[model samples]
Target: MQSGHNAMTGFVTVILALVIVIVGLVSRWPLWVWPFAAGVLSTGAAASLVRARRRRPLIPPERLLEPELPIPQVERWECVIKDVSLPSLSEDYDFQFSATVRWLPQEAPPNAPVVNAGGLAIDAVVDRARRITHQSPPHRSSLVQHRLNGELATMVADPSGRVLAMADNVRLTLADADRERLEKLATVRKNEEVWEHERKWEQSKRAYLGEDVLRTPGSAVVWWLAKNDEKIDKTVSDIGLLAELSSAANDQSVPDDFQRYVPGLAKEQEPLEAMADESTTGPPSPDEYARFLLRHSGLPDGDPRRALYLERVAEAAKGAGLPDVADALLRMLGDFPHPPQSAGPAEPPFDGYFDEDPPYDD
Candidate 1:
């Protein structure tokens, strides 16, 4: 059928060209004009014919195409109860148990080994939930908390696979103060982690964009180093881990030989003197103050103040729902000569959600 169509098209093109020549001759056109018009028409017709010849389909759409199958849609719950509470009698003799579960958009670490308590993986889920909630950043902490709560809210079974009372709408409420504290913690942890990560990343960049590269004037290496220096400086400023340097500057700690070699020592003296005169009101709570000291402490490990700082910081960390940090600070006291029992195991978990820190036990 295509061949027949092409033949018909060719015949029509020939008839049109003949008519054009006839009209040109009847009008007494120049001899050169007749040949030129015929040549342009013939060339255009040949090109069109060639293009038509080359336009064959490699595979016919109707022949090669297959019908698309409908995709199967699966209905998923907003939250799924991963584990139910083990059956146990309450003080009032009623069946009692809780569950550890996960919410939708589940991206938490896989649940750990289950401790069999009436066939319910209570311990495993609980531990996993703990790990998820342990994230330090405020926004991330809140998100993880929500996810944990979602998992917990969906619990509908007892340890023996028996259905328990389930709420139609599980809504966990938090007081404003409690919410604020969590947000503060999460933000602090996030910033601290980012500062640490960026610090390490800056160190790693030095291998490629070190001082030696910066010394190469007008080169690509020099440009690269300059660009990276801005980022490195910003990270350093944000982390603000310059307490040691600042302390040294303020204390006239530089040796004579170092002063002779290093410039700007004399110029910094006025500012240092001014800073020494300004007094701070100190942090609000012992915990907040302790954290400040922990971050800003510039004392040497063997200095007497080092142990004092750590001790105070540990107290503050514990009060701030930062048991891990507090424990770490306490471990730093191994070198100090205090009573054997002072360095005993950690205090028990804080009593209620909003409970005040109990008096520090020796």
Candidate 2:
């Protein structure tokens, strides 16, 4: 408040000084005397206002108290029955016991139980029924609760009384809130497992299959030299032969024999060599031709071939521990590319069932 008053006093003093100067210059009527008097009065008023405001304490704005959020309440009941009053046990008693349970989906619908209590156990299905009703974990987070939720709603009763088996086989009917919380926990656990699997897959990506096969000709043969029943001979398979047939080294087009086998693919050797040799293509080519051989080499068409290929692939995979690389090559061979003419959108088959069928009347 004092600072505001001081500012107003200073503004007035400046205006008065300007007026006095103008009057003195135009009419020489003691304007300088007016400015001095105005300046002194304004200075005194501004200082007094500033001092008064400085002595007072500042007041803060008042705020309203916010309301508290409502809490959810659920009802629970527990009764202890200690009074034992009964008619004579010699007569058959028609005791009733029932239990209802549903953990997931469409469970058996709930029904009442008719219990017969003979002396002793009496194979108590009704008693079992009651046990079923009360079997789930009280905290309701255990596997026991989930298991019970998925069973038949049943009963067993011995007219002869049995102690409650409170430790197992019962579940609570979840109200909306509790069910939502439990299901959320299940979802979180599922996502964590998925994330863990995804991480393992990613970590295993770089050196996945075929890394060893890239080193030399018939390299899978060289890499798995240690662990073979007899030996995995690259000489036995046509991988080397196919490579030579398709090699960019061949000045001619792919041979007819190669065409007969792989059709659209020029024996795995041709376009592959062109793409593979990093030295020929550049410092870093797309992939090595040997890599294709490693992948496509292990998959034979028939039983004996498939058997042989699996043997080789297993050995190579173990030796190199590069399943990822082998996988890429295997995928390429299995998913051979098609020419535009043969690969265009397929035509839908035509059928005229209505013309050959009975009239529309029904």
Candidate 3:
């Protein structure tokens, strides 16, 4: 557009100068008037073009980047199957196991596992998390409370399925079939995650177009897509194998009520139900419960009172017959040492929101 304007102004300047010279020669006006007029007009046109050029954007407006959208939160269910013990009380049994689950109950934050405490931000987080359901990928939901040994232990799931709480010799007996079933479920879930990641990586390759793909005559482009495709295929193959194994172990369909983010994770609810039995002892104190909830939260970098509070909480858990919880607390006392005073009830565990820089060739 600037170039077009400059060309038109130059053409006009030439025509005006010619007219001025003709008119000056033909008219009774002084000859100096025409030269003066042409020079002034030329100077004015040059000045205008220079000003317009300075104002023009170097890159087209459409090509300039818009405000970057917040990184999309990929909902993911991070399940950790810590320990599998054998035998339900019955001769015939289904799979039962102890596991920790971290539900990203929402679209997930751009900087998840560490969201802002502001009111609007909190609302958005809650809204996202509430959309959680059984069929969603990247399952996000609430924490699971179960008994580790005799103690009531509340655990927020971590991505790496480590035993968040367990006594030295506390084993929940499960039948051989149950153990096999749980193992199969674990295999399926793990491979499913791998498959999803591989699929996303493959999709990211499509972002390149125009000269990016054509510049090198498809040398790097072919290899790049092929490599990702191979990864995708391998993951799919692994998932198929695991799924077949799972189907072989239990041909029966999972009941509708039994649906959970991670299959078999609903089994954790069994203990909670048992705890509710009138014969069972009482629940943990509010403070003990509160402390357990906080452990799952990503603590701030530093704070002074964390050590003292953790010591008190550990003592409370041990008193409540949850040595596993106490021990877990001891291990983590040094791990996320600082919890903000207003951190409140810990939010459900979520995938950490790092910027998505899919490793792909451009």
Q: Assess every candidate by TM-score.
A: 0.20, 0.19, 0.17
Candidate whose lDDT is highest? 1
Candidate 1 — which residues are off by over 4 angstroms?
1-32, 35-43, 50-55, 58-127, 134-362
Given candidate 1, what's the lDDT at residue 349?
56
Q: Candidate 2 residues 31-87, lDDT tens each?
A: 467657667766776676767666744643234344575767853222222212221
The lDDT of model 2 is 0.43
Task: Return the lDDT, model 3, position 14.
Answer: 85
Q: How far out, in Å, is residue 201 in model 3? A: 82
Ranking by lDDT: 1, 3, 2
Better of 2 and 3 by lDDT: 3
lDDT of each: 0.50, 0.43, 0.48
lDDT of 3 by residue, 33-142 (tens): 76678779889888988888889677898887777858788854334443442223233442233433333332454555643223232233222222321122111111
Query: What number of backbone clashes does candidate 1 have, counting pairs of residues 3 or more apart or in separate chains?
Result: 4
For candidate 2, report its TM-score.
0.19
lDDT-superior candidate, 1 or 3: 1
